[model samples]
Target: MSNILRIATFNVHKGLSTFNARFSLHDQRELLRKLHADIVFLQEVQDEHAKHSKRFSPFPLNGQLEFLADAVWPNYSYGKNSVYPAGHHGNAVLSKFPIINTENRDISAHSVEQRGMLHCEISIPGWDQTLHCICVHLGLFARWRTKQLQEVKRFIEDHVPADSPLIIAGDFNDWSLNAGRSFAESLHLREVFEHSHGKPAQSFPSWLPILRLDRIYTRGFSIRHVEVHTGPTWLKVSDHAVLTATLAHQTA
Candidate 1:
């Protein structure tokens, strides 16, 4: 077996244009299809939107996660973090392999800014250990993010095996790079872009990305390639560009 995996993380901004001028879930789905990632971690995924459901003629009855997954990714999990009378939005993970277990943990620092982590244990046919993928969307404030990071650390220590192949990805919203050191030290994981290029990729404000607010971190894998999508097609899809990486599983 190749022992190679292509993964991507994207914050879809709830499938809207820069200022909610347009709805582009259909276009976004097409772009995701082209990535052909083995696994995809998504933030700001809309689980339900009563207004949108009625406004958009083609809105999927199931959910945005299901619509995006379509027929390609057979296994998908969603975590509803923020809920309102209109609808709810959160994180999601779509996998080509079988997802044996899934959990959504609420790690919100405060009730005002809801947040959660979507964890999935995927069974790769020939792999010795299960692949643990966590889709995270942290808070915007530095103080809240600090506490959320701690929660994430505890989640790993309590559930994921230390030596397993693990991927932690999504919109970190840590523009100052404040959490990088702590995460790397505690998780023993490396951010794909930083590991590959000595610096994290600028992924916010897709049209002219100049903020590193998104990330893809991995443990027990060697980064083969990494990049940020910032072209016109990406800009039209969401406010935050997609971060992609190819990881090679390290031998024991």
Candidate 2:
């Protein structure tokens, strides 16, 4: 039984070219497929509106989530939060295992920005218990994010099993916010990137990286390895750097 699972979290910037002119969903799909993460959590997944994307460039026919997942990833789910004249966008999850249950929670705290979380329960091959995967996207304001984080905590407490293997990852927009710590501490979640690489995860401008906004966290899994995925292909993929981790389940 190949229980060796790898998970990754990335904010795809809506499959755009890091504020550049390039707008090809296929490129984003290729980038993510190359990673081959067992469970992939993504923020800024565009669902529709070719008119807006066409202005930038012609993208693929499938929605951003489907496009990114492509045929490589067998299972996926989308949690829509933000809506605009251009279209609606949100978070998404892609997994290789059989997904047993799924839900999308709206945690938007203000009208200015929309955010959401996607929860998916997957059945792993070797594990006696199922895997819980969460995809999160927080707001811009600190106060609003705090409230959202509280809701997120409650959601976890109500839905997820405390004794099961858990993974929560995505964009926190923690430019100067403590929401990550506020909710994470209460649940005893340890960040993968920060634990392995450090606090600063150069992920903003893609090229320069000014903010530590993205993260991968887990409690029931023992992290054996972690990386920031900052190679040549990564530098051109998305504004936020993708964080990946290989977890060895804590055998009781």
TM-score for each candidate, following the candidate numbering: 0.97, 0.92
Candidate 2 lDDT over 1-252, as tens digits, reads 665788888888877766645664567677677777888998988888758556754565677777677777889898888888878999989988888899998898987788888899999887888899989998888888898888888988998889988998889888763677667789998887666765635566666667888877888877788877664454456777777889888856
Report lDDT per candidate. 0.90, 0.80
Write model 1 residue lDDT over 40-59, tens digit each, in one string.
99999997999999997688
lDDT of 1: 0.90
Residue 181 error, candidate 2, Å: 2.0
| Best model per TM-score | 1
